[model samples]
Target: MVESESTTKVNVLMVGTGEYTTGYVGGGAADSDKGAGVVALTMFDLRRRNKVSRVGMCGVNGKKFAGIRSHMQKNIGDVYNDMDLTCETFPEDTVVDPLAYEVAAKAFYPGDVAIIFTPDDTHFAIAMNCIQRGMHVMVTKPIVQTLADHQKLAALAHENNVLVGVEVHKRLDPFYADARDRARSNLGDFQYMYAYMSQPKHQLETFKAWAGKSSDISYYLNSHHVDWSEWTLAGMARPVRVTATGSSGVAQSRSMNTEDSITLTVQWENLNDQKTLGCAVYTSSWAAPKSDVHSQQRFFYMGSSGEINVDQAHRGCTVATDAAGFASVNPLFMKYTPTNGMFSGQGSYGVRSFENFIDACCAVNAGTAQPRDFDDGSLATVHTTMQGTAILEAGRMSLDMDGRPMDIQYDGNDHEPIAIVPHVFTG
Candidate 1:
């Protein structure tokens, strides 16, 4: 008799302890959308369902674990029945160690998994540590700041034979999934795409530490839409040049030397027909005023045959309260409300993203699947997501180089980016 892959329970270690991992930042629950968080809560519930085991969480400051545990106890455990939120903390409760993630990674076995939700600049180092240890990794968006680092991680993951996935949950959204499918099927050759995503200005304070110094709004927010656009036009079209512009008054006023908003215009050349080209504009900002929704996200796609529009933020759902006032909610991304007193958000695309990675890790561990099997554009693996990184790095370079256009050079075979250089005018 053979052991079933379904019966293989993989252990998980969550890296970083900010809002996305624990919903506890600066000693209390975050003021943003992920109050109960998406990562730890899902891990806790997955443990309850026996899908995973021995879940642990790691962060830079070990003292914050007390507050994080209390926050989870109140928001997640108290709300859902049979929810067990038990996990080991790294660097001991009394010690503060910046490199605690390495210690946590060492504790996990080779076949275990690690999900990284740290700041944008720290992703490559932490992910590299885990991958070298033979642990599968699922990193949050903007996987790395530079195309060079992105390529290095991809190469290392292949060398180590570990599954690596980028946590682009938007790819799992039902509406976005349908849109991608329709664009690939019904829509003709890609022509143009415009995408906008923004968060309220208050978020700047939440990320004040590294908002401008370590990263910018483009890498933090624009990565979402850029990846979607890349995923939509994969194999059919590839980005050739990128030009960017930014707005800077708001963040500078707050003493942060960063842009408040950024826009990137990318030129895409059709793979089959070099004569045909498409244009894409992606803009992101953290300076939006308070609105009914926390994040305002929408996109428009125009192809040779037809067009499609999506306003993902406002899905026609509104709620009014004297305490919080009238607001539009998106339960499709994450349904935090409990059903019958047990965790019922298993169907959420946000939840599905984590589950998909875990299942892939388990399958690989059971010898039923290989890491390369997920590179077929289904999961946002490192190999499939390099284009997004190229565009993002190019956008950053353009912003720094006085809005100069950057050129993306590809390998000509797989269409993956090989180098990014300034678009020098020869004529």
Candidate 2:
């Protein structure tokens, strides 16, 4: 494989459509479509800031339902039709076209970076292929579901010195950076951090759910949890040991082996004077806490001087210190008003998170930005696997049966079972 460089602009092709579908919700909902919204935002930035051109969409030509492809066709405006990555029609628009990867490898030059937007399992193949061909890579969070897989990726990345990154958009968010600032400014070192992405157990049931279904969730939700821990702390430490206890409700209901909910005590040696973050998630059987907080994603970081909170649904971040007060809150998230993005423009790429990948890839090509590396990916991946074990152990409580009161124990190695993502670093 030959080293490749940017000519005038970098080309980007999304490997998945789920993000695009999220972008199409009409009204304010569309405004919050961060995936599409940020991508579009980056396009505007490319033109205004760098004067670079946009590369078109990636997919088999015949696949019809992919909203990302459609959005690109509509948004890329003049050149949308020219962006097809595949030579043949996709099997179906709503479905994944496994065959598209081969075509994309051929479509891109050896140096071009391919950001894997699909599920975690498919990432290994595409990433390995890209490395073999000497192309660069970026991916959505949690690169793979198992540690063994992460090791394979690590070996390849070291062998080639290729830059790879997981989506982990939160790291780029202004909100998270503040937390980093607090830690770096001598406000405090990482003492504790907590994150959650709990949903009902029934929400996970599927016909074949029994076997490997939660394998995805174990990585999906936990990736964010562990990533935030590392990001807020700015200290990457592998969980020394872990153990989880939870029920097989999703498995019981759907014949799956994955647990519905769990709690974990993740041990990191670097932790001394600094606090730590807690990891929490909701299973179908979860009863809302006595408090009125009803939501999915939540992360909180506490330092000696201040504290920061990251909320998912509202898409906001708040920094507060008892010394000053909470009213001085700062808004960290970008808004999605009609006035925002390129909605007024004639094209569909109206802006989304995927666009960030484009900008990051372009910068890497231009030698301006370095993509995240495999080390970051592996740390977050392994930590999440350990946390999932904890969540499963949380499910093992009697209260889980009917939301009744039960004792929750803290065990050092209870959830220490195994590994679980799309996030590999791009460095």
Regions of candidate 2 where Cα sits further than 4 Å from its true position: 1-5, 20-62, 65-97, 187-190, 199-214, 235-238, 247-258, 271-295, 303-309, 315-334, 340-427
Tens digits of per-residue lDDT for model 1 on 1-427?
1222233888899999999988898889888779999999999988888889888999888888888889999999899999988899897889899899999998888878999999999999999999988888999999999999999999999998889999999999888888999999988888999999999999999999899899999999899999998898887898999999999888888999999999999998877655489999999999999999999999999988899999999999999999889999988888998999988999989899999999898888888899999999879999999899999999999999999999999766567899999998986
- Candidate 2 lDDT, 274-381, residue by residue in tens: 434332233222222311122266667655566677665354444345753432121233333233333332222223234454555556566674444324433222
lDDT of 2: 0.46
Model 2, residue 54: distance off in Å is 5.8
Candidate number with greatest TM-score:
1
User: Which residue pairs in candidate 1 collide?
Assistant: none
After superposition on all C-alphas, the RMSD of every candidate to the true structure, in Å, is 2.1, 10.2
How well does candidate 2 match the true structure in TM-score terms?
Answer: 0.61
Question: Which ten-residue region of model 1 has the weakest summed lDDT?
Answer: 1-10
Rate residue 326 of model 1 by lDDT: 92
